[model samples]
Structure formats: C-alpha cells, structure tokens
Target: MKILIVSQFYYPENFVIYKIAETLQKFGHDVHVLTGRPNYGYGYILPEYKKIKEEEINGVRVHRVDLPARKRGRLSIIFNYLGFWYNSRKWVRKTKLKFDVVYSFQLSPVTILSAGNLYKKKHHVKHICHCVDLWPESVLVTNAVRKKSLTYKILYSWSKKLYRACDEILIGSPSYKEYFATTLQIMDKNIVFVPQPSLVENSRKIKTQNLGEGFNILYCGNIGTIQMIEMIPEAMKLVKNSLVKFHIIGMGPMSKKLVNKITELKLEDKVIYHGPLPSPKAAPYFKGANALFVSLKNEGIVGKTIPNKLVMSMAFTKPILAMLEGDGKRILTESKGGIFARQDVKFLARAIEKIAATPTSELKKLGELNQIYYAKHFSLETITRKIEKHLR
Candidate 1:
C-alpha cells in the first residue's frame, strides 16, 4: 500500500508520527511524510532545516512545508496552527505524489486534517485520521474559551466536518470515542480505538546524571498548569518521607512559578529542577529513577483522554506514579504498574510516600508487570498489525 502520512510536526523534532511512518514502511507500505520544518523544541525554526524543503531520512521520503516557527506566546501558537493548516493543505492539492490512502496524525487543531480530507475527495481513497487531541473540547481544556461564545461554536462545527470527512477515525482512548459519538455525532464502524505507539525503545541508554541518592521520582515533559506539575511541590511539602525526592526535567511557562513554590515551602533539596533536556539526554534520568511520574488536569474531555507518556513510560520497565483520571487511571490500575492519586496535594503526597515505602522486591514486580502490560496492549507490533489490517 502507498500511504501519505500528514502531520504538522515530524522527524528531527521528536513526535510519534515519525515512528508510526517508519513502522508502516517496515510492514511493506510505501510511506511518505508531509510535514513542516523541524522547529518545535526550540522557539524558532532551526537554521539548518530552514532551507531544506524535502529529503529522505532513514529510508522514508519526507516533504516539508514552510510554517511559522512555534514561538512562546499564545498568539504565536495560533499563527503556527493557521500556517500549517494553509500551507500543508495547499501542498497536498498541488503535489504530484499519489497514494492508496492518506493518514493524518492529528495532534491538535482539527484544521491540520483538512489537507487529508481534500486528498481523499480528489483521489477517492481512504483518509484515516489518528486523533491525538479532540477539537473544541481541547480548546476548552485551558478554560480560557467558553462553549457559549460564537468563536467556540464556529470551531465546534468546523471540527465535526473535518472528522466526518475521514474514512476511518482512530481514537487514542475509549473515552475519546464516546466524545466523538455523543458530542461530534460521528460514531460508527469508522471509529476505532488504536492507541499511538511509543517512540522509546527498550535498550536506548544515556549518560546517568545525579538524580539524588534515595528513591527519586522523575517527572519529564511540559511544566505547565495544564499538566498540573505545580502539584509536585505542594505534594512534596506534605510528604514526610525524606527519601522520596522529585527530579523535574523540561521547561514551560510555569517553570519559574514551580521553582518559586519549591522555594516558598523550602523543598529545594527535595524537589530538584534540572531544566529542559532532550529525550536522549533525559534517558539517563529515567534509568536512575526508582519510579516515573505522570499527571494531567482533571478538566472535561481532555482530562479523560489517555496521554502518550503513560504508555511510553510503561516501555521502560519502571513503576509509574500517575495523578490522572478516566482511561489513564484505569489502564494503570489494570497493569498494576504503580500508585494513583487525585489532583489533591494530601492524596498525592500520601501516594508518593506509599510507593517510596514499598519494598524493593515489590517495586521490581510492579515494573515487570508494567513491561508485560505494555507488550500485550500498546506494543508497536500489536498496533502496527491492527493499522495494516485497516489500511486495506
């Protein structure tokens, strides 16, 4: 099968769609990615990638479209989205490339999939959309937008059309499937639950750094209100276990705020911030830690959705410490990988101490359970085979 994978972000700048495209190629499909210049990690587009529009990296052919570099402010983010929506969609229409299907890895802003929708209409081929984030509901997650407002209502209607245009809609979790069914009104045989595969391999290693002496709880990813990462400091202050240390990696708007809270409560030694590090650089921290931490703001549909980090964390063979609700909590519960807590500080503090006090042997058992569960449910082979069957 010839497949054109559409995504705003791809290789060079870490995203799971690149791995997905590679897997499809391994399955004997001709996979070509239509993406933008690699510039997501840094605020602006990297100088080297700015001039290169297209190239083949690791056997997969990539076609790059020009997009505004993702700058820091909210207005910059909006421009980045609008830029991709216009440029990628236009590129698809004018390109000579042909394929049996067009698969879009929709991370956010439903408008990105509009490019795939146009190709499907012209070619009469299947358009399979992998919805990493739902539309208006996603917009509502930050709490800045209101459903009653005309702007939100317009976006809601637009989101539905783009989704319905797809021949198949791949939902990240069961809860999202419900949202599409009850809210977007597009629930049918076309919609299926196909969780995204993890990019982390079982054997990649990075240089180990100082992650504290005792049982360290490592949290990696965006540091912001949406992630509820601030809870870490508040929870640590309440934690009586001195052995339970928290190591934070990654940066966001709330980085300073998180530091301030830690200082205010005098948790400087307990909660150590290492700033932002690339995945390869952060690998050692994950290796040195006794357990991994994951969290999400329990707000609306976005809260119920399963985060990719949860599935990715399982591949490391480490116990998980998740503070989330809905599908993520249920999956971790079923895996018996680690402990769970609500967004509250006291509960989270207790949960952290509970894991710290568990015997070494018990912790090892939990990590092994996580590995087993990940292999069974969210492994690359399991998901790839399912995707192959659908591509037909």
Candidate 2:
C-alpha cells in the first residue's frame, strides 16, 4: 500500500503515531510521513528542523512542514493549527506525489480538513482519520482551546465535516467507537477500534530490577492537562509512610508546577521528577517500579480516551495503578492486573497500599497477565495488520 500518514507529531520523539507508521513500513509497505518539525514540550520547535525539507529516515520518507514553536495559549494553538494546515496543504500540492490513502492522527484535525479537499478533488485518495482523542470535548476542558464559544462551535462543526468526509475512522478503544458511532451518529462501518500501537518489544528480554524496600510507583508520559497530575501530590501525601515512591518521567506544561507542589507537600522525598527520557530508556523505569500509574481527568469525555501509557506499561508486564473512572476503570478491573480509585487521595492511597502489600511473585504474575492481555488486544503487530487490511 502507498500510505501517507499526516500527524502533528512524529519520530526522534516517543509519540504513538510515529511507531504506527514505522510498524507499517516493517511490514513491506511504502510509508510517507507528513509531520511538524520537532518541538519539545516547552512549545518551541528546533531551529534546525525549521528548514528541513523532505528527507528519508530508516526506510520511511518524511516531509517536514514549518510550524510555529509550541505555545500554550488558546490563540497560540489556533495559530499553530492554521500554520501547519496552510504549509502542509502547499507541500502536498507542490509535491504531486500520488498516495493511495491519507491517514491523519488527530490533535490537529486541520490536517484532514486541509488535505481531504485536495485528495478528494485531484487524487481521489481515500482518507482515514484516527481519533486519538475526541477534540473540543478534550481540548475544550483545557485552557488551550476556547469552549462554548463561537470559535469552538465553528471548529466543532468543521471537525464533524472532516469526520464525515473521511473514508474510515479509527479510535483507541471500544468505548470511543461506541460514543462516536452511536451517540454522534457516525456510520458504523466507517468506525473501527484500533488501540494505540505498542512501541516496545517483550519486556522479558529486558533486565529487571526491584527499586527499593518500599513500593516505587512510576508514571511515564506527558504530565499535561488531561493527566490531572495535580491530584498526585495529595495522593502521595496520604501514602508518604508506605515504602512508596512516585516517579514522574515525561515533560509537559505542568512539570514545573508538579515539582513545586511536591515541595509544598513535603513530598520532595517521596516524589521524583525526571522529565522526558528517550522511549527505549523508559522501559527500565517501568521494570524498576513495583507498579505503574496511569490516570485521566474525571470528566466523562476524557474517561472514554485510553492513555497510551497504560498499554505500554502492560507491555513491560508492570501492573497499573490507575486513578480514573468509566472505561479506564473497566479496562483495568476487567483485566484484573491493576487497581483503580477516583481522585480521592485516601482511596488512591488505599489502592497503592493494596498493590504494595501483594507478594512480589503475585505481582509478577499480574504483570505477565497484563502484558498478555495488552498484546492480544493492543499490540502494534495485531492492530497495524488490521489497519493494513483496510487502507485503500
């Protein structure tokens, strides 16, 4: 298949979308990526990438488009979206390379919006939009996108049109597929549940470790608005006496704020902040921890979205300690590999202690089960093949 993947973010970084494209290439498929220049969580793109034209990396062709540095404000995000859409539209037109299908990863829906028109009219390329998260519903909660405003309503309508135009839609979880297909009136055949692809091999080959006498908990991923890291300080305070240490590894807008709160709660000793390590290096942290932490905000819309970290944690055979409600809770409880609590500090502390007290042998078995379940459902090998079967 000749596939063109349009994502707001990509490789040389640890995004799930990049891995998906890479996996497809591994399967003897021709893959081309259209992505923004690398931007660290601080909202700034590297100067070197600004002028980087089309290039090939590791058998995959990449077309880099110039986008403004990552800025946090609502206007900043709007401009970034518009900027990428304009530049990418120009690049696609100028290149004149024919693609069988254009697959877009949401976060920047404008990619589908911009390219869909051109593909439909000129090339008649099939369009596939992967809904990583239900936007406006997801972004609107954060201050990044204005909610309940004229601009938001217009964008929401625009998003609906993009969804309708696409030949197919992919979402990470069944709950999401149901919500969009049933509630939003999207066609059933057009929607599919293809969970986030795994980026790591089996953890059995990786060196294992037991980090300390106390239970060490690790949370690896973006510490941003949807994650609700603000609840962690109180949760840590409640379990300070346990042999529990919290390690947050990943960068985001709330990293500094989380550090400050750890200090204020006097959990500086209990909580360790190690911002953004390379994805390969992250496996050891997951191995080192006695348990992994996955969470989402309490909002109904956010609950439907699956955090990629949960699947990756399961890949490492690490049991998850999730602080979420709804589908996230069901994913863990039904799997029986982890425990969950709402945002209540006392309840979370209790769940933490429950996992902490379990025998190491039992935890290992739980981890293995988690990994097997994740592999069966969310593995890149399985999901990418499913996607390949569908691509035009």
Candidate 3:
C-alpha cells in the first residue's frame, strides 16, 4: 500500500509519526509524510528547513509545506495552527503523488488531520486518524477559552465533523474513548485504543554510562510546565536519602524556573542537569539510572493523558517512578512494574525515597516486569502490526 501520513509536525519536532512512517516503509509499504516545516518547541523554524522542500528521509519520502513560526504568544500559536491547515490543503491539491490510504497523525489541533481527510474525500480512499489530543477538552486544560465561549463551541462542532469523516479513529489512550463517545458524540466510529509506541530505539545494545553511583534517578523529555519538574527539588528536599540524585535529560521553557527552584531548595548537589540530548544519545543515561521518573500535572484532561515518556521509559528495563494520575498511573499499576504517586510533592519524595532504599536487584526485577508489559502493549512491533493490519 502506498500510504500518505499527514501530520502538522514531524521529524525534528520529536513526533512519533516520524517513527511510524519509517516503520511502515520498512514493512514494504510506500510511506510518505505530508508535514509542516520543522518548527515546534523552538518556536522558529530551524535554519536547515527554511527553503528545502520534498526529499527522502531514510527510506520514507517526505513532503513539506510552510507555516508561521509558533513563537511565544497565543496569537502566534493560532497563526501556526491555521497556517498548517490552510497550507496543507494547498499542498494536497497540488501534489501528484497518489496514495492507497491516508493516515492522519492527529495531535494538538484536531484539524491537523484535515489534509488527510481532504485527500481521503477526494480520492475516495481510507482515512485513519491517530488522535492523540482532544480539541475543546484541551482548551479547558490550557484555559484558552471557557466551555460556553463561542470559540469552544465552534471548535467542538468542527472537531465532531472532522472525526466523523474518518473511516477509523485510533485513541492514543483508553481514557480518550469516553471523550469521543460523550463529547464528540462519536460512539459509532471504529475507534480503537492504540498506545503510543516508545520513541526510544531499544534495538541497539544500551551502553550504560556511569551516572556517578549513589542511586541515580533519570528523567528524559521536555522540562516544561506540565512535566512537573519543579516538584523534583521540592520532593528531594523531603527525601531522607542524601545519596539519591536526580538527572534530568531535556530542556524546555521551564529550564530557568526549574534551576531557580533547585537553587532555592539548595539541591544543587543532588540534582544534575544535562541540558538536552537526542533520544539515542540519552539512552545510556536512561540505561544507567537506578529508576526512571515520569511526572505530569494532576489536573483535568491533561491528567488523563498516557504520556509518551511513560511508555518510552518502559522500553528500557528500568524501574519507573511514576507521579501522575489516570491512564498513565493505571498502566503502571496494572503492569505492577513500578511505584506510583498522585502528583503530590510529598508522595513524589516518598517514591524517590522508596527507590533509594530498595535493593538494586529488586529494581531490576521491577524493570523486567515493565519490559514484559511494554512488550505486550506498547512496543513498536506490537503497534506497527496493529497499524499495518488497518492500512491493508
């Protein structure tokens, strides 16, 4: 099958779609990506992508469309969203590439799937939406608009229409099903729960680096607001074990504030910041750690999310220290793979303390349990097979 995967963000933006495309291509499908220029977290488009257009990445081919940089402000974000929606439509219409199916890697804006929907409608092909985010519900989480507001009402209606047009919808988390059935009034759609596969490539031998012995706890991914990185220093303050150390392996908007909190809490010696490193490069740190920390805010729709970081941690055989609620916490509990906390600073401190006190062999056993569960549910091979079945 010649499949075209449409997404607003791809490649350098750190989206799972990049992995999906590559995997699909490796599965003997001609996979192509229609995505906006690489400009996500950094706000501005990277210099290398400025004028470059269509090209082959690995074996999968990629098509590009330009969009406004989602710089700092709310207005800029709106422009970026609308820009992709508008430009993707133009690109789809002009491209001569015909595909057997259209896979929509939907995230953030529900309309990111619009290009796939458009192509599906025009070519009379199948459109499979991989929905990772809910629209109006997301607005509630961000406080972007009130439920009764005109903006929310409009997005709510539009989201329903777009989703209904799809042949099937894939939910990244099982918690999303209720939202689809209730809020979107989409009970009849072929909505299947497909967990986000670990973006970490665990195929290669993990070369563990020494993270300075005394019980190193690892965290990888964005150090942004929702990540609850600020609680680390606060939690460490309560933790009785002085030998336990934290190693954060990513950077984001909250970097400065997180640093200030670390200093204020006088945890300079306990917390180690490695700025940001690529996933493969950061694997050693993940492999070397005594435990992996997964934290998220315990508020509204966001809490219901099964973060990629949580699944990614399970890819490596490491005992997890999960601090969140809903789907992610449920996964940890169900697998009996790691210790859980309910987004409380004191609880987080206690979880860390527990890991510090546990024997290294016990921690490795917990990691093996996580790996067993991940193999059954969240592994790339498991997910790709599910996707390929649908694509066929």
Candidate 4:
C-alpha cells in the first residue's frame, strides 16, 4: 500500500509517529510523510536540515513543510498551523500524488483537516484520523484554547467533522474509543483502539534486572500540564528519607515550574533533573530505575488519556507507579507489573515502599512479565498486524 502520513511532528523530534511510519515502511508499504519541520521538543534540529525543505530522512519519503519558527503564544500557534496547512496544500497540489490511504496525526486540527480534506477531494482516497487526544480537552489543559470560547466551539465542531469524515478513527485509548462512540454518536466500526508504540527498537539491549544500588524512580517524556508533574515533588517528599532517588529526565511547558518547585522544596539533593536525553540514552535511566512513574492531569476527562511513556517503561521491564486512576490504572492492574496510587502522595509512597521491599527474584519475575506483556500486546509488530487486519 502507498500510505501518506500527515503529522505535525516527526523523527529527530523525539516522537513515536516517526518510528511508526518507518516501521510501516519496513513492512513492504510505501510510506510518505508530510510533516512540519521538527518543532516542539527539547531536541536540537539537524544543522544541515535546519531550514525546512522536503528531503528524505530515511528510506521513507518526507515532504517537509514550513511553519512559523516560534511556538510561543496563541497567535503564533495559529500561524504555525496555517503555515503548515498552506505549505502542505501547495506541496500536495504541485506533486499531484495519489495514495492508497491517507493517515494523519493530530496536534493542531488544521493541518490534518487540510490534508484529509485535500486527499478526500482530489484523489478520492480513504482517510484515517489518528487522534492522540481529543482536541478541546488537550487545548484546555495546555491553555491553548479556552473552554467555552468561540475558538473552542469552532475547533470542537471541526474535530467532530474530521472524526466523521475519516474512513477510520484511531484513538490511543479504549476510553477515548468509548467517548467517541457514545458521546459523539460515532459508529462503532469507525473507531479503532490503537495505542501508541514505544520507541524501543532494540529490546535486546534492555537489561532485565536492575544493578543500581538505590531504588531510582524515573519519570520520562513530556512534563507538561497534562502530566501533572508537580505531583513528583510531593511524591518525592513522601519518600525522601527512604533509599529511593527520584530522577526526572524530560522537559516541557512545565519544566521551569517543576525545577522551581524542586528547588523550593529543597529536593535538589534528592531529585535529579537530567533535562531531556536522546532516545537511545534514555534507556539506561529506565533500565537502572527500580520503578517508573506515570501521571496524568487530575481531571475527570484526563483519566482517559494514556501517555506513551507507560508502554516504554513496561517494555524495559521497569515496574510502574501509576498516579492516575482511569484507563491507565486499568492497564497497569491488568499487567500486574505494578500498583496505582491514583494521585495520592501517601499511597504513592506506600506503593514505592512495597516495590522496594519486594524480593529481587520476584521483582525480576514481574519485570519479565511486564516485558512479555508489552511484546505480546504493545509492540509495533503486533500493533501493525492488528492495523493490517483492520485495513483488510
């Protein structure tokens, strides 16, 4: 199949969609990516490719579109979306390429809306809308869109239209699937529960056991508002005098806020912020950690969103300490690799202690179970096969 992926973010940007596109390419599908230049991440852009123009990064063909360089405010974000849409439309019209399927990842609804609309109109192709988060929910949490504003209603209506127009809708969590089906009155056949895959390519490199001296609790990936990263400070306070060391290795909109909180709490000695490490270097942090932490915003709506970090931690066989209590907790409980605290500092402290006191042998077994479960259920190979079956 000739597949065209239109995403707001991609490789060297520390996102999973890049790896997913590449993996699909490996499976004998011709994959083409239409994306904005690497924009929102702590990673540095490639020196040569810094100024955006279409170029092949790997085997997959990529059409790099231009967007507003700065991503600071509402006006800037809107401009960025417009820029991507404008450039992407020009590229698509100029090239006049026909694809078997058009798949787009959503961050700003505008880019996908433009491409999906173009593909539907020009080539009469089937569109697959892969939604990582519901728009208004994400925008509200990020402060990008106000709850009851005109902009919010417009984006919400557009999101619903995009959902309805697509041949299939891929949501990251089953909770999202249910919400779309029941709340939005979308048909069951239109929604597919397709969780994101971890960027763990070399599973063989992941050490099954921890050799580190202390219990290192690692929280990786974005530390944004949706993550509720401030919980880390309180959770650290609960386990301060213990043998556990908290390591946070990521940056986000809340990075400065988290750093300030850590300093305020005098947790600089206990909590080490390593900033953002490359994808390859991040493995050791997970491998050495006795447990990994997963958090979601303390909201009823946020309970349904599953951050991709959890699956990566599971892939490394690291026991998880989930701080949210919805679908995330459900997955953790079903896996039996760890326990959920549901945003309670005391309970999180106790959960860490329980993990700390578990015998190394039993911990090792649980770790293996975690890896086995991830391989069976969440690996790209498994996921793509499911997608293929659905496509058929």
**Model 4, position 128: C-alpha lDDT score:** 80
The digit string of per-residue lDDT tens for model 2 on 1-392 reads: 88988887787655777777878999988999988788735478776676887788778999888877668666787677777888888777887688888888775454445664566557877888777777546657565557768878877777666677777888767677665655456764468877776677577777655566677989888888778877787777887455778888887788888988988988877888877887777778888898899988776566666777787888888778888676667777767888777677788888877887889999888888888788788887888888887785
Ranked by lDDT, the better of candidates 1 and 4 is: 1
**Candidate 4 lDDT over residue span 1-392, tens digit each:** 98898887787676788878887888888889998777664333345557757677668888887776545566776776777778888777877777888887765454465776677668888878777767656677777768789988887777677677778877787777666766566774577788888888556776543535677778888888778777777777877446777889888889999999999989886778989877777787787777788888667455666667888888888677778667777777778887677566677777767777777787777777788889888998888766655544
**Cα lDDT, all candidates:** 0.87, 0.76, 0.86, 0.75
Scored by Cα lDDT, where does model 3 land? 0.86
Instruction: State residue 122's C-alpha deviation in candidate 3, in Å.
Output: 1.2
Model 4: lDDT of residue 204: 70
Tens-digit lDDT track of model 1 for 245-355: 999999987899998999999988999999999887887888788999999888777888788888878988889999989899989999998788878989999999999
RMSD (CA, Å), candidate 2 to true, equals 2.5
Q: For residues 165-247, could you state the per-residue lDDT of candidate 3 as single tens digits?
A: 99999988888898888777889988898877887756348788799869899988888777889889888889888799998
- What are the models' TM-scores? 0.96, 0.90, 0.93, 0.90
User: After TM-score superposition, what is the CA distance of residue 217 in candidate 3 from its true location, in Å?
Assistant: 1.1
Top TM-score model:
1
Q: List runs of model 2 lying over 4 Å from the truth.
A: 40-43, 72-74, 109-113, 178-185, 204-212
Residue 3, candidate 1: C-alpha displacement in angstroms: 0.6
Best candidate according to lDDT: 1
